[model samples]
Target: MTVTLAADSGRLPEYPMELDSAQSQRVERLLAGTVISLHDHPIRLPDPLTAETWKLHSGQSADVFGGDAIVRSGLNVVLASALAEPDQRRLLSWAAAMRPQLLGPELSGAESLALAMRGEGSAVLLALEDLGSIGTDLVGIEELYRAGFRSAGLVYNTGNALGGGLGQSTDGGLTEPGRRAVAMLNDLHMLVDLSHVGDRTSIEAAALSTAPVVISHAGARSLWPSARMKPDDVLRAVADTGGVIGIEAAPGSTRVSADTTHDLDAVMAHVEYVAELVGVDHVGLGPDTFFGDHTQLYSAAGWSPQPVPGYERLALPDYVAGMENPAEAPRNAASWLVRRGWSDADIAKVLGANAARVLESVLR
Candidate 1:
C-alpha cells in the first residue's frame, strides 16, 4: 500500500493509499485493458510552503497512472487563469516562446501506449487545457498540435474570442471564429473538449464538428444541478456525435445529495446517470485530479465554483474521498464499477477503449 516516488529523484512527492485484498484485485483487473482519463491536470499542484507561488515540480511516480494499462491523457494547463498573474500578456508571450521546448516531442495517444507496453514510461496524451494560449490566431492550434498537444478545450471558464465558457453571465455561444476553430481542430485531427465551455457553445461546437467532441470532465446536471455540470441535451449532443462524457469528481462538482463530503459514490452516481441517459459506450472517467490538496489549491488560486440560483450556498469538501489525486482516481473508478457488477467489456469501454476509439479516429 506504499506508493513509490517518481523514477527521477527530482520529482514531486506522492502519498500511499492502503488497499485491502479485494481492492487490490479489483485494481489489477481494472488495469487489464487500456484506460484513458478524458481530462485532468496532472502537473498542477498546490505549493506547500506558500500559496502565493505555484509548486511547479517535475516528479511523477508510476502511481500517477496506477498501472501501464492506464493512459494519462487530457488537459495540461501551462498557466491556469486562477493564479491571477498581473501581467497576462507577458506570461502568455513567455508561454508561447517556451511551449515548444517544454513539450519536447509529439506523441500520439497510440504511440504513448506503445511506449508504456514496452515498460518505457506511462502513456500520456498531451493536451492544452484552453486555446487561450493561442490568443486571437487560428494558426496557434496547428502550432500547439505540432508542439505535442493532441486535444484542446476552446475556452476556460469565461468568454474568449473563440466562445463563451461556464463562468460567463450570459453565454454568447460560439462565434464565427469559434466555428472556424472547431473546423480547424477537426481538420487537424485533434480532439475537441467542451468540459469548461458554456452550454450553448458546447452544443454548437459539438454539432459543428465532423469528429466526435468530448466533454472531457464534467457531470450530469440532472443529478447535481450545478452550472458546472452538463445538462441532458448537452450530454445527448456529445453522445450523438459518438463522443464520451467523462464524469467529473473534483470536490463538490458531482455530489448526488446534500452530503457534506464528496466520495467515490457521488462520482459514480454521475457516471450511472450519464450512462443511463446516453448509454455506457459514451461514458468514461475524467476525475480531473492532481497531486495536492485541491480545495486548498482552489482557495489559494482564488478560484471558486460558479454559484447557481438556489444552490449558491453549497458546501464544498476538502478532497474527494477515494479519489483525492490522479494516482487514485482510475483505480477507484474501475473498482467501483466492478463492485457494481459491470461486465468486463463494459468496464473496458469506460476505462479507455471508448476514448481510445475517439482518439484513434481523430488523432493524426
Candidate 2:
C-alpha cells in the first residue's frame, strides 16, 4: 500500500534542515553519547529484488563517522550487530581481547563503554542479530556478559530454541530456555531485545522479561505495513516496559516508494510515526545500514531469507536522504523535528536519551 503524505504536508521536503547553535550542540552531544546502529561492523544483506548484495566497504564505513583516525571518536556510542554466534564472539574479542591492538596509540570508545555503559566519551556497544550463537544457557550468558557483551535479540528472522522469529510460520512464545534466558539476562543486567521476533514472541518477550526490551531497528507497521515493521499495539507493549523502538532507515522499511526512498523525508516519516505512536521518549535512531558505494548510499532490506508476502519488491536505490550514513542521520532528524517545532528536550530523547535510558536501566 502506498503511503500518502498528510494532506497539508504534500511531497517530501528538500532536506538537510539547518540547525541553530543550541540545536546543533544538542545533536552533537547526542552523537557523542549514543547514535545507535552505525552498522560499524559487517552484515550480509541479500537483496533478491535486485540480486545485489549489501556490504559496507571498509574505507566507506569509516568515512561515515569521519576518517579512520576519528571514526571511533566521531561515533560516541553505537550498537554493533553481529548476526551469527561466531560473529558475536568475534566482536566481543575485538572489543576486549584485541581493542588495544586494533588501535595501539588510540583506544576505542568501545573500551570505555565496555567498562561502563554510561562511562566517559564514546564507545561501540555489542549486540547480536539473534541468540543463534550463544546457547540458551546461563553459563554461556554469564561468560558473554563478563566478556563485555551487552544486549541481544532472541531471534533474527528464524525461529530457534529461544522462540519464533518474525519469519516463523507461527510463534508459540518463549521456549523453556527462552524464559530462563530472559530471567538470566535481567539478573546479569544484560539487555533483552525483540527486534525481529514474531508477534507472539515480541509480546511474550516484553511481558516475560524483567528488564525493558528494545526493538533495536524496525519501522512502524501502521506507517508502512512491511513484514519488518511493528504495529502500534506492539510498540505500546514495548513502551509500557520503558523500552525503545529505533526506527530503521533501510530501503522499503521506511514505507517510501522507489522514487522517494532516496529522499530524506522517507526516513523522517517513520521517526514521526513512532514519536506520534508512542512518544518522542520511546523513539530513537537505528539506521541498521551504512554509507557506501552509491553517492546517495540507499540500502534495501530483504526482510527475511525467505520471501515476505507483499514485500518482495525492494529494489536497491541510488540514495537514502537523511540516512545516507550515521553522521547525517541525527542532523537530519534534528532538522525535521525543528521544522515540526519539537522542543530541544524532546528532540534529545528521540536522538539518544531513550537508548541511554534502556542501557543505564538494564545493563549491569
Candidate 3:
C-alpha cells in the first residue's frame, strides 16, 4: 500500500520520496472524498497554485479532472489580462481582496492546495491580461513567454495599435505591427488567442499564425452570431491548423435566457455543433468564469462593453445556479459529457486533454 510521490523538477527544487502504507491510505481516502464532494459541481479555483500544492503535498491526486493523466499533463492556463505590473506586495494584496469573492472560504483550503500545486508545476496557468496604455511590448511579451506565457491575445474588446476589436465599426484586420506581434509570439512559442479579436482580425490572425492558435473563450457564430462567437468557417480554419476552439460558458456567448431552466442541454448543443463541424478533438471549454465584478475590472482599465448584437448578460446568479465556481466546472462538464454518451476518453479530452494537447504542441 506504499505510494511513491514525485515532485515536478520545474517547481520544486528537491523531489520528495515515497510514502508508506498508512500515509498512502490516508491520501487515498482524502482523494476519494474530494472527488465525491465535487461531483457534478462546477467551481473555479481562480489560483490553482495553492490547492494544487496542498494536494501534491498531501499525496492526493493533482489532476483536476478526476485523475486523468493526459488531462493533467497538458494542464496550463493563460490569463486574459496583462494590464499593469503590480508590485509583488500589491499582487498579494489584490489576491487577498479577491479571494473571498473568487474562492469562497468554504473552498479556500482546496483552492490553496490547487494554487500551491501549480507553484510546484503539477500544472501551469498564466494570466494574459490586456496590456495597459503602455501596451504589451515585444520585449515584455517575450520575457513573459520565457517565464511561461504560452498563449496571448492582442486586445480584449477594443481597437489598439495591434488591430481593431469585434466592437469596432471598421473591423480592420491585424495592423502591420500586429502581424509582427503575432509572428513574435509564434517565435516565442506562444499560442495566439483570438477570442475577442474582431472577425477580420480573427481570420487574419488565424491565417497568419505559424503555430497552432486558440479562441480561448468563444462560442459558435451559427448558434449566436455575436461578435464573441466565431463563424463556422473560422472554427474549421482553427482546427485545420491543429489548433483548438474553446467553447465558453459565459451567458453572452450562449444566449441563455434568464428565465430558462438550468438544463445544460443548450450548452451541450453548442459543444455538439462544434464537434460536428471540427470533430471532438478540436473542441474544449474556456468557461471564462470571472472572479468578481469583471465588468468593473474592464471598465476600471478603460475599456467599455459593446452591445453584442445577439448575446445576453451572463449574470452571476445564472452562472452560479448552474455551476457555482471554477473547481466545480470540471466535474459538471464531465457529467454533462457522460450523459451525452461520451466515452470517458472523449469526455476527458473535452474537459482538459484537448487543451493540454494544444499546449504541449505549442509550448514545447
Candidate 4:
C-alpha cells in the first residue's frame, strides 16, 4: 500500500483503506448502529451540502441551502466549493457562526468521521476561486488556510494568470506564477480542484501536484463530448495523481433541454465511463446539479450549451427528467450503481468514501 499513482503511474494512491474490503469495513463499522442512512436508502431523504438538499430537490431557496444545509444531508463533512474572493471574509464569518455546529479543518479524521457516522454535526471545508482577495500573492494562500480554507480552484469558467479555462482560445497551460501557486497549495496541504480548468491546465496540474487533487464536479466528455467535460487523458491524469472525478449534473454534461427525456440514464453513463476507464476507485459522485430552475439558474450564471469548436452540433436539451437536483440526485445515482451490480463497498466509495479518503490524505 505504499505505492501511489503520483501523477506518473495513473493509478490510485497506496492508502490502506483504498482496498475495498478494508474501506468498506471501516465505513460500515463506523455507522454500525446508526439509523440506516436514507440518503442512500431506497426511500430518498435529505443531504446537507450545497442546499437544503431536500428543498433544493424540491426547488426552495433563499431558505436553507449552502452551508446551513450540510448537517441535514447525512454527511459528516461538506466542501464549500469556490466561494467568491470578494465576499469570502463575510461568507467565512457567517459559516463560522452557524448553529447546529460547523467545524473547521482542524478536526482529526477519526473525530470528523465519527461525528458524521452519528449524524451529529458537520465539518465545513473551505474552497476558494481566485487569488484576487490576496493581491495575487502565493504565500497569502497560507493565510487563507489559517482562516479555515482547505481547497481551491485556479480558474472558474474563465482562465487567469495560472492557466486556461474551457473557453480559452489557446490554452497556454500553467504559467510560472501558476506553478508557484500550486507549490504553495501543496505546502499548505490544500486540495487543488481541476473541474473548471482547461485540459492542459488540468493535465499539468495533475502532474505538478504532489498530493492527489480532484475534479470536484465534472462529467466524462467521452460520454457526450463537450468543452466543459474532462477527456479520457485528463481523467487518467487525475487518476494517476490519486484524484477523484466527481460526476456533475450540469445541463450540457448530463442532460439536454431541447429533447424531452428523462436524463437519469445519461448522467449514469458518465459515471459508468469513469469507472470503466480508471477503475471504480477513481470515480465518485459529485453531482453539481442545481436546486432551482435549470434554465434560469444556468443562464443567469452565463452557462449556455453553445457548440464548442468540434462539438458544434450538440446543443442543450430541454429535459429535466434525470437526476435533477441535490436532494435526490445522489440517491438516484446510488440506485444506478446498484442496478449496474456494483458492490455495496464500491457504492460506498462513490457516495463518499473516496472523497473522504482524499480529504484525510491532505487535511488529516
Top model by lDDT, which number? Answer: 1
- Span of ten consecutive residues with least summed lDDT in model 2: 2-11
lDDT of 1 by residue, 1-364 (tens): 2222232111333224455687667667667556667776554343361334332322221113222112342212111111212233433443454443333355554565555445455555566567876667888777766655677888878768899988888999999889999999998888899988999999999999999999888999898777889999999999999999988788888888774457888898888889899999999888876656667766655677767567777767867887666656776777778777788888888887788778778876
Residue 289, model 1: Cα distance from true site in angstroms: 0.8
Clashes, model 1: 2
**Quick one: ranking by lDDT, best first?**
1, 2, 4, 3
lDDT of 2 by residue, 140-172 (tens): 677666665677777777778788888777888
- Model 3 C-alpha lDDT per residue in residues 210-237, reported as the tens digit of each score: 8888877676878755676788877887
Model 2 alpha-carbon drift over 4 Å, by segment: 1-15, 18-75, 85-98, 101-119, 135-138, 256-259, 291-308
Task: Report clashes for each candidate as comma-separated counts.
Answer: 2, 6, 44, 16
What tens-digit string does per-residue lDDT give for candidate 4 at 1-364? 1111111111122212123555444444433322111111111123222223433533432222343323333445555443334444654553354322335445643465457655666554546654545545665677666666677777656687678877676888988888888888887777888877889988998999999988877777766556778889999999999888877765666442324343667777777889899988887766654444444443434435535556567555543344555444554555556556677777777777777777767764
Measured on C-alpha atoms, candidate 1 has an lDDT of 0.69
Question: Cα lDDT of all candidates, in order?
Answer: 0.69, 0.62, 0.52, 0.60
**Candidate 2: RMSD to truth:** 8.2
Candidate 1 at residue 157, lDDT?
88
Q: In candidate 4, how many Å is residue 211 off?
A: 0.5
Estimated TM-score per prediction? 0.80, 0.75, 0.64, 0.72
